[model samples]
Target: MMELDPAATFRQEAADLLDSLETVLLDLGQTPADRDLIDAAFRALHTIKGSGAMFGFDRVAAFTHDFETAFDLIRKGKIDANHDIVTVSLSARDYIRALIEAPDATDPIIGEAIVEELQRLIGRGDAKGAAGAAAPPAAAAGASLASGQGGWRITLAFEEQILRNGANPLALLDDLRELGPCTVLPDLARLPALADLDPESCLIGWTVTLAADCPREAIEDVFMFVRDEMRLAIAPLAEGVPDVRPGFTLDMAEAAAEPAAPRPEALSAETASHPLPGKAAPAPAGAELNRRAEDKGSTVRVQAERLDELMDRVGELVIAQARLSQLAHSGTDLAIKAIAEEIERLASGLRDSTMGVRMVPMGSLFGRFRRLVHDLSRDLGKPVDFVTVGEDTEMDKTMIERLADPLVHLIRNAIDHGIESREARASTSKSATGRIELSARYVGAQVLVTVQDDGAGLDTARIRAKAEEQGLVQPGATLSEQEIHQFLFHPGFSTARTISALSGRGVGMDVVKRTIEAMRGAIDLTTIPGHGSSVTLRLPLTLAIIDGLLIRVGEGRYIIPLSAVEECIELTAADEARSRGRSFLSVRGELVPFLRLRELFDAQGAADPHQKVIVTAIGGTRIGLVVDQIIGSHQTVIKSLSKLHADVTMFSGATILGDGTAALILDVAQLVSLGQGRADDRTPEAA
Candidate 1:
């Protein structure tokens, strides 16, 4: 087992926390008065600060101290979570992230500037009597506590894993001291032996008698971060109770030594059956430790490299299993074939399990873009309401990551070019606030992610003029709307009269196309002149493995993605002869274009008398691939082609056949495009 790096672990945790913090901050902007949002933001900051300090991110912890305080004030109603506050808080959150991600290059003054701005906004709120002078939570709790005894007795029985969760007991004690006078008695009864102790574990509990005139709620707030993992009990001190600090009487000592009362929530079975000696039963709150244990056991953070390595091993196993099955089937031994079949079943299951492990929900990618949209709306002065659908759609992790940049380009284009300005939209009788919807859903075996905008769509006339100016097409060449839209993706092709930071260099969409295509995906563009435009990306669910239909064109075997295959039909000699040099075939009265693989690959042998045409759908276009033979379905482990073969766009990748021979995986999208182009170039009579 590899030893985990504490610093790296902290960084990962911090990154996740930062993401959540950003989301909460964004939500708070819309619901400024939401108490729950305020508390959530505070807790996130507090956790980051504590964890950062513990993991040696001193600068991060230092910066977050003030940030956390801002939210704490909001939580206490001492400040309203208004737009200005949320804005500055977002900036502060970014600076904190920078501090964690790249501390060496980050300047302290930038952080100080953000904090200064935050203080100014907070000062302005203070000028308004802090939201109508509502009493803070601590003060209100104190007022209620003042009605009883002046001091309180508190018991804290922290779970063993509290330290791992980033809670510092000494810090909690110091916070209690800040409230007022306090006396803390350490409970060392549960301390483990030095030889058996885990440094990361927190075994010591605490008993405290506070003479502070602070409220019980204030004391409870001190333990807020670890409250869910610790047992806490608070009660007013009886009059004339001795200060057990100096001389503890029998009763006083006994009371101080007693375990905290069990909370009301039910405990887990394991915890109930094996209660710790002399320790309070962990009710629902204490059960958090058990739950954390179970959760830790259930999910682990494996490195991406490790997962890739595992997938490679699984791929090799699949190939080996295929070879075994091939050997077994070629023989006459029933037992050997049975064993081979069982192994094949196991390998198939393993491949599925491995692929499932690599699948992640699209929401992770979508969540990051929310902040992008928010920032862009502010910068571009376009009040856009960003919406998302089918966030739960899952795709390969590698595909999801690569899709990010492409989606960014698409979204930017939609906002910068497709969306109209407030005034422009008003003149068009459209809503002042434009809408951009980013959605993902499963379409058969592929995932379709669309970035759409309700604004002035593509200017076909302008695009045509640009295309003609660039000599991308003949000056008077006729083109469909889609053909014109395709020009938008050409390198250095832009209709914008002038260049700007966001676009007009004609760079983004081309990059989007290249990236998507590199991931074995295709892009589709549709637009209505004045209504809107939607760009949908069709991508495979996984790049690692797939179900493929293996076929033969002459001597070469090619794999067609099973997901893309609609149906396969025989291509008779009569049908081939009647084509009259045109590649179109009438399928159910539809003129479906077909590509002869033998012609494309320049096969040496004569065409088979019984040829097969595999009809496939790619990006809403159907095309047929004629082959000499059909080799049936296969569990294809995708192995990428070498750079030497990179320019060979006819095949996406390659896979190993059951007989230990390499077969190229046909690029369905490219084949479909080729077929469509072939059909488009034909004479009208041929069409």
Candidate 2:
């Protein structure tokens, strides 16, 4: 029921177009001669330009016009999409995004410079001249036979709702005129009466006799933004040309007067809705209109903030349902219990549905990195082949967004420090082009995103020397490889001999670790002596709502994320006495380290004789948590801890219980870490 902001809508849509433009440019860098990529790039640019102009983003429109002109030449095979051209185009795309997103802060000089560089790459000194030169090659000879001159007859009839979708027919007309001479005539046959007119709707169509010696493709490009939402026909200008004016078969007045039904279209030569201009017309005009209608009705673009607010409401509903269930169980009201049960079912369904809506495929996030990798490869003079796998895997939108910066840091470190230089690699019998592969897949209820680089692996001796030199560890301390790797994540920890623009101010990896842990995720690192290194980030699919196992350590209740719990077992008297001096428990012939929540929280109670162990697996290690009681499963809506308790590592967050009491959510990673430390204390080497 809320109206969308037109400017905000344009900015969002332009962002998507710019992303596509970047991707196309990157692809063109590989296959410079691919006509399809060239045309696709041009179409993306054209749409951005048209939509930007429609939305009063004048700077964006003007800047993209120059960019669109340069790509038009590539589409026509006049210019090759070489590395230089692709690089400049990518910069141009960024500038246009800046112009749309932050026009006040964007420098016009930078935009002009990008355009000049693009033109220079394409062998054109004048941007305007290059655009003007895109006319049909036949125009150089003479006029065509149709109109006794080189010209075409074009008719355009847009849907009545076109204006509402932020398209302007006048802009198309203006674009057409820029090619050559034009005589525009309005078709008033379908015009409604003045009293019956809807100011927001467009009914009048246009017939233009264009006298420019241009290709049909050039004219079709003018309507790139509205091809699917309109009826259009183009033919050589000649006497008795097939009248395609039947586009206005569905009058606005009649459509509003009658019962709503699918809009109709009339078949005419060259009259049909195509995905893009100049593509083969796949369906009749009527069928195309119906298809467009179906497509439009299939999706709704809701704002992200709205989705977040909906999720908040769903969370609240879940908490209230929990309270109602508690009351229903306590009281002996059969009718109230039935109602509570029904509400619980509805609430569960709503939570799942809302969470599903927030689940976005990881491909969208991964695609942006292609451009980043491209730029880094060029900047570092490293011909690296960046590969991504499991792009179809979906994750929470919030998690994906927060993961961006961390992943960026990881990848930058991989290329700057992990990947060997071309010359360095040749001496070691390695491939000339280094490889960095990023992959994601499901591991139980968690998603594992790994960034692996096949280069000289981390120098373990160097890391230890640096750690000992900095007094982080004892001079004669015995440590595991995993423990030595942990030193890399210490603040201001770096083993690089020298600093460069890419890395080595002793930053990046530490921040990556902190950020991942902040999201209730764990980071794992593994390296071979000379093969490669991989960092896998284990993260929950959604952070908003999770299935949790409620437990009581003392008087205080705590919720452990159900996803991380492997199993719960009883701590018998014999087992407790055997491990009295240590926190290790034997589970199925494996010595699993355990942590006592009672001692950790300093709970005020006598130790329970029959405590339980909740086994959890984190980063391929099992850690057991000892608790007094195991409550049943509960749907947990995680709430962030306040700044007052932000430094507490044991608890990740808090959630509301059925009795409206707040219970802290256990931070499994921190507990696993503590258990590991405890296990180290019990080692003979430490002794």
TM-score of each: 0.87, 0.87
The superposed Cα distance between candidate 1 and the true structure at residue 361, in angstroms, equals: 1.3
Candidate 1, residue 450: lDDT? 94
The alpha-carbon lDDT assigned to residue 357 of candidate 2 equals: 94
State the local distance difference test value for candidate 2. 0.81
Off by over 4 Å in 2: 1-3, 124-149, 155-167, 183-207, 227-231, 238-246, 250-297, 684-687
lDDT of each: 0.80, 0.81
lDDT per residue, candidate 2, 177-261, as tens digits? 9888899988776677999989877887777878976766777778654566676667675542433323333444543332221
Judged by whole-model lDDT over C-alpha atoms, candidate 1 comes out at 0.80
Candidates' RMSD to native:
5.3, 6.2
